[model samples]
Target: MSELILGIESSCDETGVALVRTREAPGQVPELLAHALHSQIEMHQAYGGVVPELASRDHIRRVLPLTDAVLREAGVALDAVDVVAYTRGPGLAGALLVGAGVASAMAAALDRPTLGVHHLEGHLLSPFLSADPPQFPFVALLVSGGHTQLMRVDGVGRYALLGETIDDAAGEAFDKSAKLLGLGYPGGPALSRLAGEGDARAFKLPRPLLHSGDLDFSFAGLKTAVLTQAQRLGQALPERRADLAASTQAAIVEVLVKKTLAALAATGLQRVVVAGGVGANRLLREQLDAACAQRGVRVHYPELHLCTDNGAMIAMAAAMRLQGGLEQPRRDYAFDVKPRWSLEEISASIP
Candidate 1:
């Protein structure tokens, strides 16, 4: 039987809603009908970062409208939704609550069921939305918000953590380093843009844990190195900012690519799935493609737009999980969000 899933994502500074439909075949991937997202970047720019309270408020204002837009785009009515899915954790409490509350309320009104999705899992499985979806038994490099992890994935709800960041994550390295160079809000993208104009060899930045003989990452040190270099440039900082950005990006990319290859070697997996917001980095993608191609390995990624947190991934994850019988939806409207849940916990929770 086919089922329509309505997904809501409000884990951070974005309000996203998407509609997905389960395929008739048991093992087939679900179809993403439509998705809508409203980013709070512009709203939070003045603050240089997200204001939890403001993000929560904006979610409240955008969730319904976005949901409506998704439904309209999917050419479906609210009542036609068979299951309501939403991001449940590892995010701001207020932001998470907005999505959870909305999803639970909608499910309750329709007297259907609700499924709470792990934010990281949504990102991890996002590549399934792409044209070339990865098969099971792949190495997954997750580089989102404040997390950086390598996991061995065998199937839905089957995951083993191989290595992770001991301190700051890859995304943090980009944002923090960008801030040190006086780049405004949403530093990662800004830094990458400026990097295109400068020489990556103009400056030498540290690639922390690049030779630790393990996949564990430590970008906090890299961030510190960037700060030190910025301080040294003092008066010349503005003019040399692009070079610094390029160098910083190069260092981070090298570390990520090396660690990812190490992970693949450790697991002996021929395929890798790169997901999460930082997975959208152009340099990262280019380097990974080059590295993987040389080793006769396959690399997969979520569609550019789906690389970040979005309702499409949440819906896709929920649909896949349900299809795999890894989770059971509940009509019990009582719902809660996990602002600190880990993907390991999710793997362990499966019966």
Candidate 2:
């Protein structure tokens, strides 16, 4: 039987809702029907960063409306949804509660079951929603918000961690480096945009643990290096901002590309999947694509829009998990959120 899954994602500053319909074939990916998102970027922009309390309140206002929009777009009534899924953890506690509360309440009111999804797992399996999806038995480079990890994925719900950031994740490195250059909030994208205008080789920055002999990553040192360089630039920092941005981006991308290549070499996997927000980076994609092409390896990425947190990935993950039999939705209506759940824990507990 085909199941219709309604996914709610309010793990952070964005409120997203999506509907997905499962395929009849066991291993086939689910189809994304409709998705809607409301970003708190504008609201948070005044503060220069996400404020948890305000984020939670805004999510409360947006989740239901976004859900309605998704249902309308999908041409399905709320009652038609077979299951309710939500991002259960690894986000701001209040933000997570809004999604969890709404999803559970809706499920209970409909007398349906609910599934709690891991935030990172939503990212890991996101590429399945892309036009060109990747097959299993591939290495995954997950670089989102505060988490950076490399994993081997054999199938849905089957994951093995290869390595991860010991200190700041790649995204943090980008944001922190951007701040050092006086770029505003959500610095990663800002920095990347400015990078296009300057020479990447204009300034030399540290590439931490580039040859660490393991897939584990460290960006704290690199971030500090950017700070030192920016401080040294002093009054010259204004004219050299673009150059610094480019340099920082280059350092981060180089480490990511080299580490990913190393992961492929270690696993002997011919395919690679890059998910999470960093996967949308133009330079990272270009570099990784060229390197993988030369090696005769295929690389897959989530659609640029799907690279960030969204309902589509959440819905897609829920549908895949249901189809894989890795989890069964619950009907008790009692729900909880994990502010710091690890993807490894999900893999460990499932099998």
Candidate 3:
């Protein structure tokens, strides 16, 4: 019989739940039986970013229904879940607690074990949920609102940090640039859309630290460059705004692509996986795809919807760990949240 795992994620504004079944095949990926996500984008839209207290409150209201929805959609009873997995750290403490508390309570009632998944690990392993997943030991570029990192992922529970941002993350740079150009909240996607219609050469934004000869990224300066250019425009004309957006996007994409290619060469890894929110950038994807094509390297990304926070990835990670015997069932509810958890600190064994 296959083991069934229930994954819960409420680390931020989204409340997600998923049920996955372990694959019996030696190398086959796990099966996602049912996946559900409740995004609080609308609720947080007025606030420009996630409001921690509001996010925590909403998760409390949505988690139970989301869990029930997933179980029903999967045609499985709560008692059928063999293991429960919850995201435990690197997020708002209040938001993290809602999912952790609920998951532990559910596991206790079901008499099953539970696992605490690292948020970034879920994002890094997300591409595996697809049909043509990359093999182990590849470079992972995690570009999100809170983090920008280059990591070497050897296998489950095996990750080495190559480099990371020293200041603003790539996603923050996007949003900040967009705000300067009069674009609203969640600026990355909005700016990318406008950029699609603008001239990439009309403006020349600086590609910060593109030739620094180091893996560390610095987007804070790049954002300042955008601000300076936007200030010169005075009235923020439509054409000027679009051009600024396009130029900024191009600059960011160039830096990311060049750095990733360099990382690939340094690590001798031909496979690259892009994870996190900014991984959804159209230009970034195109540039990486084109660059990798020329070098005969493969690039992978999460299904667009899964590019953001969701339970499917967390559940999948849990399933893999359990199948590999790296994690065992837990009958106790002693897990704590890590607001600033580091992926490198994760040991092979479940805590």
Better by TM-score, candidate 3 or 2: 2
**Model 3, residue 4: C-alpha shift (Å):** 0.8
TM-score of each: 0.99, 0.99, 0.97
1 or 3, greater by lDDT: 1
lDDT (CA) for every model shown? 0.93, 0.94, 0.89
Supply the TM-score for candidate 1: 0.99
- lDDT for model 1, please: 0.93
lDDT of 3 at 30: 88
Ranking by lDDT: 2, 1, 3
Query: In model 2, where do residues sit more than 4 Å from their true spots?
Result: none
- The residue-by-residue lDDT of candidate 1 on 231-320, one tens digit each, is 999999999999999999999999989999999988889999999999999999999999999999999999999988899999999999
Clashes of 3: 1
Provide the clash count, candidate 2.
0
lDDT of 2 by residue, 1-351 (tens): 999999999999889999999999877889999999899988988888899999999999999999889999989999999999999999999999999999999999999999999999999999999999999899999997689999999988789999999999999999888888899889899999999999999998889999889999999999999999988989999999999999999999999999999999999999999999889899999999999999999999999988889999999999999998889999999999999998889888666
lDDT for position 218 in model 2: 97
